[model samples]
Target: MKKMTRYRILMLFSLMIVGITAHSEPYEGVKDIALRRFPWLAKALVFNVIPGIDGNEVFELSSVKGKVMVSASTASAAAEGLNWYLKYYCNRSMSHFGDNLNALAKLPEVGKKVRVVSPYSHRYALNYCTISYSMSFYTWKDWERELDWMALNGVNLMLAPVGMEGVWQNTLRKLGYNDQEIAGFIAGPAFGAWWLMGNLEGWGGPVSQSVIDQQVLLQQKIIKRMKQIGIEPVMHGFYGMIPSSLKNKQSIKVIDQGIWAGGFKRPDFLLPEDPYFDKVADIYYSEMKKLYGEDLHFFGGDPFHEGGSSEGADLAASGKHIQKVMQQNYPGATWVLQGWQQNPANGLLAGLNKDKTLVIELFGENTNNWEKRHGYEGTPFVWSNVSNFGEKNGIYGKLQRFADEVYRAKNSPYGSFLKGVGIIPEGIYNNPVAFDVMLELGWHVDHLDLKKWIGNYTKYRYGKSNVNVDKAWALFLETAYSSPEVNQEGPSESIFCARPAIDIKTVSSWGTRKRNYDVAKFEEAVRIFVTASKDFEGSETYQTDMIDFVRQVQANKADQVYASMIDAIKSKNAGNFKSSSAKFRQMILQQDSLLSTSKYFSVNRWLQQAINFAGTKSDKANALWNAKTQVLFWGPDNNPKTDLHDYAHKEWAGMLSSIYLRRWDAFIDREFAQITSGNVSEPDYFKMENEWVKTGELYTLKPLKKRERDGLVKRILANNQ
Candidate 1:
């Protein structure tokens, strides 16, 4: 009996030690990513967790017995360390355009043990607009790929407001609201980002119940994946954005938030001080918990996004009450606020607990909101950049500015409150380099000189670097990716995608047609980049970039043609106008053909993805319409001259030939008539745009053969020079 008891005690003691050792292993999530993405290298890689110095996340890389060993404080850090080795040593990388994550013949040796400590605690990603612009049609497969990328890049916090449609539906229904009423409150999939931001109530939808249910399932999967990888999702939280019609049915003290941009009616705000506030907030969070889960820690909702009335309400007390309700439901939850164009008002800031609130400085590249607002009045803030807007196609990013601003913010007077860095691009699809550099900054304490940094970037990005490729990037940094101390919305707008106008000031509203960099330098870079085609013929990353650079040159040429046409119109040179306009039309056709060579630049991919996401034929049609309308004329339907038209413009293959070129044809013909004769005709573009969306044409990819694509690229580059 004594021997048996001693044996049991020893067994229990051994089991406890085993558990401790297992728990101390490097995060399994990071290991999972390695197995899934780089199976060839995974078997040779060992991961182990190490204590971080002074509560900061850190990663170490070393080689042990012919194996790559990664040690880190967290899963995100482990993933970053793995990526660091892949890029610096293996000369391989991944991006949205294409990944060069091919099987390695042998693992790269780490000659010296390398260690990196992250200064920032919170590395964030996504903008409200990013959900719609970049990922509206994403499926579980798409999201899985995205989450893997996010984890690898060390994104610990991400905005995930997808399943809120069901949450609101349940909350409103339980509060005695009918189905029809609930339908009116939920926006369509493409418009959910704006809807969540309290900009509009229902524009893209009267969404079907099944689709809403699908969103719930999708969000559950998303958050699950995010949590597994150590990323905390910023789920949509209740911030008094109720339907305006709720006032008629209930006794809540409602503040009407009149109209949003593009003529959509804004949702009403329930006064947080009202007795109904607690009850409605309770139902909202309860429904949220029932739909999502109980482990959520971060909540995102902005009241008065862009512009909305706060009339007859105590702003300070209202902020306090709103935050209190969130804490009551999810204890120790953080209220994530956007610092953009006078938001998180001083009155609002005065009432919140500084430790529990995080402000995202949305426009870090152009505006120093973090610095200007004195670190959001000394509240914890993350510096973020919105490099791309509306997913517009053009090569742009102030690469050095991103690194400079982040380092500056970290060392500034409010450095103590500067929590971390983030990539808040309204659209994430366009610039891979921008996102890559910005995210990597979180791992560094000092700023990186982009001139030196992009050399290693080119080596990894294209699998190997050539001298011509290196020279092209040097000019790329001087031109497209140059850091000019001027405020710009996004990449330079392509005049090819612009609405036809003799005096074109901008393409979409708030977007400039100005190629801020020297166009000749950019064209020269394109010419040099094309020279490496033979060397990198099998490289998808090189090919995609080549297509983009050539496309930008075509866009720049269109600008010249446009200038000539306008000059002819002004001087009554009808012959010159006719020739220039004809050239412009031909250029659009060629541009369409060039864009067709990649799925990334195909409008068919967008429409087909949307249609594929739906079940019923009617749902597919609705989804297709939503897809078309969003890219062409993001609308309120009644407003013809809506500023929102073409705001999400793509210089895509199908879009150019089918919609933009068609609209331009009508306008050009009208101009020709007015110039040749005394006839003044106007193209009703709004009607044309609406008709195009209803056409129900599902465009398909027509990728050109490599020989044909290369020839076309060569011809375009030669002609431009």
Candidate 2:
């Protein structure tokens, strides 16, 4: 009787343990991401989490009874395994522009168990500027897709400084600062990146409390989703940046960081030695923990970022004190620093605990700072590429250079501290191929042959490999995507996006107008790419690429017209000038029509996104203003001649029609009149631009029908040829 009673109790306990294990699904988040993105495939997929192989994330792919099985050591690895199967076996993929994740009739059989293991300790994504340039007005829906893509691409660490406004607001409130003073500290939605970097303060703001609260909620959701997918959120760290007004409030040693570019005053640097510094930092971290959980492990901030003054301070002590406060709040946290243009100074390095720090080489495409600085003075660092600036529309990436550099870094003498690889584009909206190749390098142990890789990329990117498509990609490899040993910021600047000038060398201040690749060769590739359009009419990815390629050819032709018009101006040929100027204006209008065929290149879509994110009427107005200003004048309201104007220029459809078109018209009409009848009047371009921003007009247009779009492409190609 006693033995039977003991057996019954043991059985009950065993059953209870089974119930708990069944409820806890470790791979559930990744499964949900797969389902939400590729609903058809998700239902036929099986996921299982197993132990890691030698402390590195691993995934095994196979097919069992017609269902795709992905067994991984972690959720992120499972998502990557699912991506690999989709790309290689299924011939489907996702990108920033569009997705090719259509339903398959049947699951493709993985005949053998295929396994992949990432060699890097960390895989990171995003830039501080990406917060404004690519994702300033992102809603939860946008974030959902962003995080989903991150998981599939194996991004385990991402910079996410989204809701710092609320943190600052609460921290200031606790420190006896008024609402008005706090308002002066926070920047607007479109300009938060600069604010967070300590380059400027209150330039685009005096934001409503409602928007602040909304961002706080949005950040909460973002962090929650990221944690589930196994991606660490690198929140903004407090690095002694205080308002310039803080001097009037308290007696403390403050270094005046006088001014930044575009005449904006930089925030004052608080001496880390001051007692007030510790007090303020404690409150700041406490509020941050209250808002975002204490489970955070990484923080990103740079002292003296982007030419800010770090005058009259002990560099070594300041660095140590900053990291000390951070460690005090969150034990074992890593302080992530940007290695760009003489940053993470040697003195600062001398003070840091190397084990608790990670540096990101921000300009790997153009600079070999890692080698130059000896792997950031032996501190753990990630090799990174900042391929695009301001998210400019250009077909540019040194595909071979990317592969060569990553391979070189991994095998270099300083390889011991080379922690991982990452993509830190100022804008992540363009050049999807560049990012895909960079991220996938983490999984590769051997150096890649980019030529063969391009063929495979073409296959998965468009859902099939055609002879014409393959030929075009080869031409692409030699032309725009070619790795020439030259220093260029992004793809060649579009002449159409340039602010109207007779001798314009670049569209933005630091951008270039020179095409380093062969324009004719690029055109030939576009020609061949168009030939496969008939086979891929139903593929969204193909259609989008077709529009983009054809658009590049149009931009090339605009450069020719611009040169002819300038030559006419210099030679005093009024008739030639008139014809060339008219042609340029007509091309701008035509380009707008061409871009209208895709929402990806539509300015109306961007504005709509900004408007849709706002809850109140006032918020809507502010959001719209923020959106328009950012892509155009990007201003300090008072500085009309600010060199920062058109720094974040876009070549979108409605933007050309509404903003650039008008600017060109004003300039051209005046120039033509001056040439023909000696009437000279300079247009107040800054005033004209600001007026356009306040119009509240959305230049919405229906996308052209397929037949119309095809005809437009053909017309453009023929005219350019």
Candidate 3:
């Protein structure tokens, strides 16, 4: 009998407790998730688990006595079967946009058995992440709907970093840090993911212990739900990332990760070469096991993530030791790495054990890194589509390219490394078609014809089809959303969401405002899409899309106004300048009004969720500050040195009329005053922007019926033309 250490003793105790309660059935929560989202489907359909090949989890459907039947080997594959019945037979469908289901109607008679076997073992979701920006404050209620959305779309592996700050809090305190010191280390709800990965640190601090404790409990619930639904929740792994303050005290060799996004202190990387690294990694896992339990299999963390300093480091040794630490505690675990922006470097991949590692080819839409890097140097990888960056609202996706690329890689020489496919939007709400089409590739055996697929998609999307809607989508395929003939990142940034400038370089710091598609042709498609609005007026999905499309049209029209303003300034004509400025201001107000009609476009909903996330008044204020800053002026707070302003800018209703409009109004006033007086005047935008950041502004958060935006969409379309 071997003597057990204290941590080892706790692990055994936990195992004994967990053994009694653990259920081994894989597809446990398939029905519960379905009932939560679509209760009516329970009466119409049935799901069961059956044994099959590992990657080839199968879902088969049959009909008897007017009852639809389903048999699936996994929860997600079962949901896919439910999805198939919803789309092909019943013509009722589910999408990221919304659902189109008619409970009163009967399922179409299934004469032939409809069976779909997923070819890939992994179909994943999220980035590292704008889910923080878009939905950090999301409660279990919000998550219930989202998890249902994930299951319906067949997302099996998801980045569920909901409450990692709590883990960090407990982990650090046990490592000899005071509560105040620990508070300074953990970021707020908005910046939790980035801080966890060692990119930037302590920008959104000092988080309270109560919040941290609350989050630990919340994460337990999130993981439980994820496991139940057959989705493997990827939690933040401890890869020797400690606070920068850990230097010069302990004998441990801590490599300073330095600054990221200008002047924000990056967490010091704990050198695996140092023997003290094992101590930190040990306690971290011990604490993690206590809070989250031990059934977890996937761990996500990157050391030199997006410009972390790599001095005093051995790359190969670091990778090996990090993965070793993770495997030692959590047996037979897979290390999930981000294949983004020169990450999982040749040396890094060389160190990782091939069988136990999986790399997310994150920028698959833009870069051919997997092929160039020899499928992450022949290590197993997922060919993922990260279409949306920062979750900016844009009607853009490389739809045909996604189907083409995923299929092309599947049959390529290095095809064995291509283990799966995924939808990795930094934020997920925008581009329903982009996500819908990508996830479907998991079940596909060959190349998909997006042109033909759109016909079926439109029918299922709106619960029925219309000739005009079909024609509009035909034009859509060739224009607005057509895969760029050249390389493009995400969607065009809307000028309405941009900081006020006549010749704005880019909407976000690194993003472009240039429309890659032919604007005029896309406008024509929008006009045609609106023609069939009455038929799809009942569709929440269609109406939601219409409002989004109309907003895009109006945003595109603002380009002409911007051009007119620039021309007036160059020509030194005050009359033209005043005229263009007024038109620009009016457009902002109209855009706000149009957006207010839709629930999804409400800024109030976002900010209010942030406020509600906190307990006390001070925490609520802090939460609101963090919320507003992320979407409007991404911050290090009032500092002129920060270049992150407008990085995550949203073009939502309340945001437009409130912050953006106010900023533009001030810019136009100062510029108009100067240009008219025969003097060139440049407004001090940074000064004005800094002042706005400190102001306590709030937006209304109320839901409205889609009908409110009915006439408004037409008016926007009519005026833009």
**Which residue pairs of candidate 3 clash?**
none
In Å, residue 708's CA in model 1 sits off its true spot by 2.3
lDDT of 2 at 660: 88
Per-residue accuracy of model 1 over 75-149 as CA lDDT, tens digit each: 888888888998898888778888888887888899989999999899999999999988888999999889989
RMSD of each: 1.9, 2.0, 5.9
Of the candidates numbered 2 and 3, which has the greater TM-score value? 2
**37, model 3: CA deviation in Å?**
1.8
How far is 503's C-alpha from truth in model 1 (Å)? 0.1
lDDT by residue for model 3 over 1-721, one digit each (tens)? 3555877898989998778546453354877765665677666665556776665878888997877777888887887777777787767776656678766455577788877778888998888775686678887777777887788778899888777776777777787888888877788778886787787777677777667777777788888888777789988788878888877557778878877884677889999978889988988888889889899999989889998877768888899999999999998889899998899888888888989999999988888788998988989999887777777888888888889899999999889899899987888878888888999988898789898889999988887879988998888888767877666667888888877876886888778888888888888888899988878767888888887888888998998898898898778788999989898889898788887877678777777788778898778877877777677666676565467777777888888887788778877887777776756566665676655555666666443455555666666777542
lDDT of 2 by residue, 1-721 (tens): 9999999999999999889888876688888987798888888788887888788899999888888899999888888898898899989899998999988888789998999988887899999999998898999999999999998999999999999999999998998889999998899898999998998998777788999999999999999999898899999999999888888989989888888877889999999999999998999999999999899999999999878777788999999999999999999999999998889898888899999999999888999988998888899999889989888888899889989998999899988888888999999888789999999988887998898888889889999889999999999999999999999888788988877887999898889999998998899899999999999988988989888999899998889999999998778788999989899988898889999998889888888888997889988888889888988888687898787888888889998887788888888887877777786878888898899889898879667788887888888888443
Q: Once all C-alphas are superposed, what RMSD does model 1 give against the true structure?
A: 1.9
Off by over 4 Å in 3: 1-28, 53-55, 678-684, 687-696, 701-711, 719-721
User: 273 in model 2: Cα distance from truth in Å?
Assistant: 1.1
